[model samples]
Target: MDSKTPYKANLIKQQKVCERNFHKLMKLLPDLENNDNLVLSFYLAGWEGQARFQVLERAPYTTVLHVNLDAAWGQWLKLPEFRIRIYRDVRMAEIISVNKDRHFKAIYPYPNEKMLMPDEKEQLNQLFSEWLNFCLTHGLNN
Candidate 1:
């Protein structure tokens, strides 16, 4: 057996977790067929992944809320290191970034009192739910 086999296998597992969580987050966004202001961009590569949900405004850099989730793994690690960044401005004037080492119990837009795994459904759901609400209340128009 190749020595790299186990590492590759672990990476596959982490990639699936990232993909599944990415889809869960995507479901919470308003449908793309009906809304042009909101866009989702996702990319995954073996043990690493990145997903972004962006709310655009009338003018570029005028207004935007960008939520990004990134995951990666070190050798021999089963779970990837996950990080979440919430950016409230087009120019990224206001930003919050959290890593997996932190406990995640509450949702974002609120104090994340605890840390959470990147793939945890409940936290992902709450995060996206609040994001959608924020977009709507702030005039996403779609």
Candidate 2:
């Protein structure tokens, strides 16, 4: 085995990330529970962009949200899209999918099906965290 952080799940970090994500999501969409979708325009000097958050499913204590970043990201035409699952009771949110790829494992075999990294889930949640931080810090409904 490679000498690394042993393959243990980082529950503490994941939980923290989830909680922060939930908080930022609520900040971006204060009417999330009452409304089905939220649209925000981001304007900074010469650049202007938009972000859309739509609730795909809603339950008593759970909600699935689809976030679309509507902007030109260099050469990529599709940009980035995220589907997040929110747990209202726990005040947590996690990335269910990114750009439509849903499967994530805490650890994966070296020669697995998709060449996924060992810590795919952790990486995904971290990416979500960074994205949310960027949106909250630089853009939004404020």
Give each model a TM-score: 0.25, 0.87
| Residue 63 in model 2: lDDT | 99
lDDT of 1: 0.37
Model 2 residue runs over 4 Å out of place are 1-6, 74-78
- Give the candidate number with the greatest TM-score: 2
Against the unseen true structure, what C-alpha lDDT does each candidate score?
0.37, 0.83
TM-score of 1: 0.25
lDDT of 1 by residue, 13-97 (tens): 4334434434433455546324534433332343443344454433432333345543354335442222333222311222222
Error of 1 at 86 (Å): 14
